[model samples]
Target chain A: MEGEIRVGIGTDADLVIARAEGRAMAQRLGFRRPDPTLIATAISELARNLVMHVGHGEIIMRPIVEDRRSGVLVIVRDEGPGIADVGAALRLGHASRGGLGLGLPGARRLMDEFEIDSQPGKGTTVTMRKWRLRDDLERLREKRQQRG
Target chain B: MSVAILRKGEYFIASIQSDLSDTEVLALRDDLIERVGRFRALGIVVDVSALDVIDSFAARALRSIALAAKLRGARTVIVGIQPDVAVAIVQFRLNLDPLRTALDLDEALALLELRPERKPADGR
Candidate 1:
């Protein structure tokens, strides 16, 4: 929780904040080109989903580490009328709400891992992560730089 | 101002300065559409190099801007999409059909001047 950041998604302005923060965090975690941009785009989609449908939600971002790989984890949650059919929502080009219908599926394609949980009448929670691995030479260079 | 709109000759140029909110994005679209009709411009260029992320909503808004401007008898060319941003857009599989793009503002201006009659293939 030390490195976790939570942003309230109550308005369109909040989406801007979440996207910038996600991109910054990804860059700090050493995510290479395209990954940081991808993460930021994914954050935008999830935050927009809340603003469009539920009108309010929260996005949590934190650095993750596992098995010699470092990554960023993003969790978006909203307390509103949940999805009736998760499958339908994830299906590309199916605009359940007359929008582009690409938010969920597009975010899924941008990240390495994705999971969504929704209960009709309850709420929806989405968790996604993107990882980056440092190769041996890069690790050695980092060690050398640390020594100096 | 998040976006700057300038007039050069017969075209209107709207350059987005930074990341924009949904409301601002829509506002830019509406503003451009109205300007195209009011000015009776021949072409319009939208610069988005400052935007690091172009998600589905932004992407859709762009296409809408192009189509609406076209309806007003003005050609629209999008300029300055960063390389990383382009990659993310492709991965998202966002539909940007009918929206012409140029590497920069100069090319966009040239594109409008080159072919004034029919739609040309996408410019990278």
Candidate 2:
């Protein structure tokens, strides 16, 4: 990850905790500080989802940048049962189990871009990207805040 | 990284001094379990006053340590969570569910009102 944060974790939810450490290390190394908070937060939710739904998964964190700037990309993949309702999962106000009612939605909310891939008994891969030091993206984020 | 132990009533307090990273956390988890495995303390309060940041690795290590202590027949409590940090956990929605949180060392110790240390020959 050039300027983005990257991390990998096991299927076990307990092991997924390493995601936070990864973000912190990235921030310490000067990749991005503010975004790591959201990245780590989303990463934790995805990890919990994997443990709760898939039962096993891996999280890979890397940087995503257009030019020579910095950003964070989190990829959470699982191998077990897959989601049956991708649309419902992405709904702004949906939840599984008892989370902030956010997890997937919240993940999408906190990042610059979010994508999910899943199938019936196959698995799921969630790719989320958040960029720091990007002016246009930052302006769009500010506009979102204003709208909120 | 180091853990300083203290005696409060019947519980022993462990004050950690380090970042509590993965390697350090694993060692702390094991050593605390081993030390408290045989002790007959009514409870053990771990003081984290020295730590500035605790991530999932540290939290899991704390959770494992607590569980290991429970298996050893002693209650475990994590004490002294800074308010700012707690806010961060919430603001970022950091998942510390695996680990138990406490207000301070006093409350943690008071939760058990630990009894006096058992004599070495008593074979508790």
Candidate 3:
């Protein structure tokens, strides 16, 4: 329950490593078939955010327990110029910086718990905890489909 | 890159592979839409176990397929939800739950009275 993997890379947002990390980390937690799908999604979003928004950032993953269950805590931090619009960034269907608009908000939704902080000229930090099964997230995901 | 359909009595069961990227899904979308109209299967189950990841494009694509099937008078259900994939839906907060999901291929087929579809019956 105590393993930390740190990645410091220049951000070109290559997806292979992020995807592999997602698979390995999820498997270690005994996460089943489709859960890897979720983790891979979050991993890709965070890694892409690091590479794209932060330009150069780091990804640190650790294990944590939420609601009396095991889950992973993924912390993505970038020392780039930071975000000018934190509120706007989290809004659905809003991506202007080469992302699918799902990088931050998407990662937030995929995990069991989501939190983020950023400054316009400083940096950004995202923390996400994902479980083997989370209800709130699933509900939210389904809601949007209905709206659209 | 794969297709498996199970037939039980009258219902046709089909499960798609997860390796399908956005481009691949686009093609499948068209094929399935056509099949839905042609076959008149009572239901559909798409297996997403192979896809190690999901994004907005993928999420939207799934919805499109479901909509397409519904238009063809078929009720579509998605199957093979890996835990991580579920997490991605939650974390990325994508709009996928409306489509449908199952834990495995067998459960997926069982739910809709379907069997894995492999090929056309002797070219009919």
DockQ of each model against the real complex?
0.85, 0.08, 0.28
Task: Give the clashing pairs for model 1.
Answer: none
Over B8-103, each residue of candidate 1 has an lDDT whose tens digit, in order, gives 999999999989999999999999999988888999999999999999999999999999898889999999999999999999998889999999
Question: Chain A structural similarity (TM-score) per candidate?
Answer: 0.90, 0.72, 0.78
Candidate 3 is graded, for docking, as acceptable
DockQ for model 1 equals 0.85
What are the per-residue Cα lDDT tens digits for candidate 3 across B65-124?
Answer: 888786777767777666655665665567785686777757765666654356787852
Model 3, range A46-124, lDDT digits (tens) per residue? 7766766666788887876454356777888888887787888888777866666766676676667878888767888
lDDT of candidate 2 over A1-148, digit per residue (tens): 2444334454443443555565675575355445555566566667767666666667777655454355666788987677788889887556566433456875676678889888777888888777656567755765698799
Worst lDDT run of 10 residues, candidate 2 chain B, spans B84-93
Which is superior by DockQ, 1 or 2?
1
Model 1, runs deviating above 4 Å: A137-148, B118-124
Worst 10 residues of 3 chain B by lDDT: B14-23
Point to the candidate with the largest lDDT. Answer: 1
The single-chain TM-score for chain B of candidate 3 is 0.76
Off by over 4 Å in 2: A1-8, A11-17, A28-38, A67-69, A87-112, A134-148, B1-7, B12-78, B82-85, B92-124
Candidate 1 residues A54-114, lDDT tens each?
9999999999876468799999999899998889989998796757789999999999999
Which of candidates 2 and 3 reaches a greater DockQ?
3
Model 1, residue A15: distance off in Å is 0.5
Better of 2 and 3 by lDDT: 3
